[model samples]
Target chain A: MVDRHLFGLGLRKPHYGAFLDGAEPVPVDFVEVISENFMVEGGRPLDVLRRVRARHPVALHGVSMSIGSADGIDVDYLRRLRALVDAVEPLFVSDHLSWSRIGGFNAHDLLPLPYTGDALAVVCANIDRAQEALGRTMLVENPSSYIHLPGEMPEWEFLDMICRRTGCALLLDVNNIIVSASNHGFDATAYLAGIPAARVRQIHLAGHSQGRALLIDTHDRPVPPSVWSLYAAALERFGPVATMIERDDDIPPLAELLDELALARDIASDRERRAA
Target chain B: MTLRALQHGFRDWLTSESGPLAGRYPAGLAVYLNTYRAQLMACLSDSYPMLVAWLGEAAFAAAAATHIDGSPPHGWTLDAYALDFPVTLDGLYPEDPEVAELARLECGLGLAFVGPDAAAVDPSRLGNVDWEAAALHLAPTFRLLPATTNAAAIWSALAAGERPPPAERLPQAASIAIWRQGFTPLFRTLEAEEGEALALIRAGHGFGALCAALVERLGEEHGPARAGAFLGRWLGDGLIVDVN
Candidate 1:
């Protein structure tokens, strides 16, 4: 049965001033930030974050941690991220189980990591170092994949092993699961079943674009019905996780996002009611 | 392949045509290359809007492709990626000073918009201080730029949704002053005298030296007055943060 669940929306720059204006009431539990956006020394972004934090809980979701890079995490990047963490006091901080930078050059995409044993060990070590440096455990989100490498293990096993080894929590993005499952020919339900229920701390729901060969995890559209179904399965497995809708590009109005978030809330609430 | 090799292969494939996507994952490879290109190009466009206006979308994208090839982003944040793009554009169009100047103006705006917030300079406390002993501190967001073309006007017009004036080069060397005033970032051309004085101040020149320099430029009678006028302007512009 679902116990306690929270709904949130990913905060983007376009809606910053609106969120601060306080004219309309938003119906989400907290706002998740891209983390790097507010990693400035002092500016309007930080000021807005401070004002927003005063109003709602914040979750620092980062894109550039590169936690799976074999070259290791950038020390200065970690210190700056930690500084932002100290300042924001987010409910929790998280990044993908993918790497962005390699060999001193950063591609800035949530680039895939081969799900090999060595890659798993590297990411787990990096996560451990990151948590130690930040003085707190961080949740690692499962990223949408485009291709499966030759010799890598299953994505779910990679996630399970990383969380188990590093003591990190799972973000368990359901949309990513559906997107990857469609792209790589796997069952989204089986992917969820492989994950340990107690380890999930949050759930990310978003939309994907249908490509000719694969589904692209572009968080531009509303959550599709198929992803919503997978999210229900996730809720059944990892009950009552903190859930948020993530939209990065072609952002709709705050009201539109709130409506999508309400659907997630309704789905979860119904699941809970049925259990009751 | 090892994770390191796979990632290295990923980066190589992204920046080049015939890199490591040779035997595997061609479908996914195109998606990532498209993403990296789109992301970095959007950042450059944001930082250099006037360049886009001058060079249309297709031409701008082509030129930006060269810049992107020359300098991949090395920072954690894309905010700072366009910092060196003006130079890259300068090299791309050495004969067209307007390109680099417009990129510089746009980049300056981005910097001023995100730079540290500071308390506005207090003008009333100027009376009790000794002029020569006080070294003025410039605001954290304040920047001085030497302009070669009417790029500032182009940027201003683009900002105000008006048609650009003309792309003319200046006969005399002029500098543009950019800083964040309240929440708005602004830039304006500086008179030679004001620019010189700001240069001296930026170089840690004291008030006495500034006054003497103004005296040498103007007559003795109007020199200190002009210096005080500059002081008033700096304070009013929120350009100075401290006096030491």
Candidate 2:
């Protein structure tokens, strides 16, 4: 089980110096470190990460493990990733539930999965393997997809099956659910309703940019109001999961992000308080 | 499709120029793949800005597209995607040593940024070692590049997002040292003699062997004194690590 933090924000390089200086620690209860950014040797990123870890709890979010790929997990990558986890001792570790590689080549993007029975088995096995390697429970985040595969079951059913089989927790990104559902013409509420409340461990709130007809999870802008409303709906259903705001590009000042995160914290708290 | 077949099909769609895979995917899937390619190219362009500016966006984009097609990212992290970019660019820009050298330096910086962190040994620990006989172990993030052009200057300027002046006639030979001292990555252009000494030391040559290489390269007339002075400066600069 993960700690119930009211809100967290994705750590970025722009805020590294301020974080080291202990300038603004009030806005977030925790921060999410992109695992690869600080994996490198003796540098500012690592130094800042150490400082941040000292001040607040961190969660390591990784992009590359390609857990759903048929070619098997990259052992070398895992070793490095494990070494990082040891160094940071994050609150929890997580990766996308999609594959980013095939036949030794990486697309560097979270490629969509076919969502078939075979993919389910492969993903569950990979999650089991990853948890065993890390010696800890892992959370699998739902990826924002612009494309759907032919064999994929409904996204929610897939997540349900994966968590049921592997005992891994889910990091449900509300924005992703909304975006993918809108793109695919599925009911976002139905998608949210399908996720087992007991299995959800974390929540991600990020802004998405619109492509010609679909929403792209660019993480460059502020969290859209519609997504925020959907998050409220998720809280009503899932009951105040650990939520974080992820802004990766055109990032605003730390205060601005915290303002956004504070809103989430308030929303989650209000819902929890109401339930009580 | 079987998992393997599905993977192969996806790989083909991502890499090859063919559009038939577009038909295979569900409606609107092709748009996603195209968007994926564009976003990836944007990232590659941002990461290798100097290289892109030097090669011009069109040519650089073509090269990046080719590189992506040839070696799609395997890790979720894009930080290490262009690790072999310099070698590939070297093949493409054989006559432009500046381009190749700049790519190497840029890649080195990127690697230092993302490579595994090692605790830097405090210089105070070196007081116990015999400086004259000790072989130096450069930090795990240390990288040395010998180049035939003024690429280091160009790279540094580009890193600062400054436009470099036109390459004034290429230099005979030069070298650059890149390493993470503390948490900040530092790069410096090294003289031929300094580069050779550091190279020998990195190759596990003892202090005596480094002097020998310096003497062999620069001759005895001024080699010993120059090498000794350079070693002192390197130690002060935090460039040399005590291996013993």
Candidate 3:
């Protein structure tokens, strides 16, 4: 098991050097890496992951599991991912709750799925296969959305049902919850309330791009205040779940991101006091 | 629709310019389409920077959009997503073979950067080889590419942030060789003689057979000498994995 509470940053290429070198005691407890990037057989990518893993606990966050595809999971992909897990020995593995590939063609984007019973079964089955193959319980993060189908169940209910059926944990991205609420016309707080707090094992906080009529989870900017508000609410319900700040584009210096991570630490620090 | 049908529908929309969502165009549909194009274009541009540098954004983007639609990523890693983009570039400018060559060189560099690791062949161990039966194993990251145009020169200049040299076809057939040396990607033009030998070596030829082919080109007196010289260069470049 991980610590009682931990704060981290999504490890990116731009910050690779600063992270490996002794650049004076960085503040993050653990680092999360995009698993597919380090699924290589051998190279600088795997080397760097090993060096960082020596210092901090690593969480393997994946983007291409396509866990909701009714066609079933890819065995080769699972093998490679399992190989990486053996090498890195990460604390736990995670991927988005959305599907990425279809018909053997990887769209390379996290596409939205309709919240239905059939979709739930597909996702839950895939999760069971993944967990069994990985030899551990996996966390599934909620994805930001662009569209949805009619006659579907609520998003929170879908997430909650996935956990109940598969015995998998959730990696709730507070910003995704906020972005989906804005795009699908649902209340964010109610979305939070619907989730079983005990099942949420981690939280993701990131920035978004506001288009003319929709919000995009771009993950390029600093954490905005609205997302922070949602995060505080998440802390209230799921106290001290492993928190991480993810920045993929326009990445600033490590110091700038450390400041944001500090803010997450402060907010999570208050959850216990507030509950008391 | 079934979950499978819904996913296929989503894919159809992602690859189509006519919008993927049904009914009234929600602003969110535009959001998805715009991000899809922008993100895929970025991946293609990163894969073939020199080609985009030479073709400029407007032209590259037009071809890239087509490539994205026709050749959706078959691999999980986006780094591997644009592997076949040079085919699109080749079709776009069939008259200019250099366009495809440039893309090949760029793609080769990316592959070499992430390919499997191997120990460089030891020069001290070179002399113990039985030439009659020894086969040289090339590094996994090593790539040998035939070139007719000055694509290597153009790729080099663009990679260095300099204006490309004048584009012209070479008088003789040339080749580009790339391999990673201690985690850094390195590429250079291979000599005509060495380039021919590389092709034979990659085709699983033994040392004695490689020398015989060199003898066919360089005569008996200098055949063994020339093959030895090329072997030395490959060893120094860390391109040889082992001798078996």
Off by over 4 Å in 1: A1-3, B216-219
Model 2 lDDT tens row, A1-276: 644645788878788766667655645667888887766655566767888988888999988888899977888778778888888888879999888777777777787888899998899988888888888888999998877777757988998998889888899998898789888888988888888988888899998888777877888999999899989998887775678999988999989998898888888788878888
| Clash pairs detected, candidate 3 | none
Considering summed lDDT, which 10 consecutive residues are worst modelled in model 3 chain A? A18-27
Question: Each model's TM-score, in the order given?
Answer: 0.96, 0.90, 0.95
Docking class of 1: medium
lDDT of 1 by residue, B1-244 (tens): 6778888888888777555676577788778888899999998887787779877888889888998888887887888788988888888888889878888888887888778888776778777877778889888888899977888888778767798887888888889999887767878798778998999998988888999998998889999999999988888888888886
A-chain TM-score of every model: 0.96, 0.95, 0.97
> For residues A38-76, could you state the per-residue lDDT of candidate 3 as single tens digits?
888677888898899988899999998989887788898
For DockQ, candidate 1 versus 3, the one ahead is 1
lDDT at residue A20 of model 1 (Cα atoms)? 75
DockQ of each candidate relative to the true complex: 0.70, 0.54, 0.67
Model 3: reference contacts kept, as a fraction: 0.73
Docking class of 2: medium
Writing each residue's lDDT as its tens digit, candidate 1 over A52-159 gives 888889999999999988889989889999999998888889999888887778888899877888898899889999999899989999999887776567888888
Q: Please write out the lDDT profile of model 3 over residues B1-244, one tens digit for every residue.
A: 7888877776677776442354434676667667767778899998887888988889888989889878877776777878899888788888888888988998998898888899898889777778778898888888898889999999888879998988889999989998888788888897687888888888899888999998898899999899989888888889888998
What TM-score would you give candidate 1 relative to the actual structure?
Answer: 0.96
Going through the candidates in order, what is the number of backbone clashes in each? 1, 14, 0
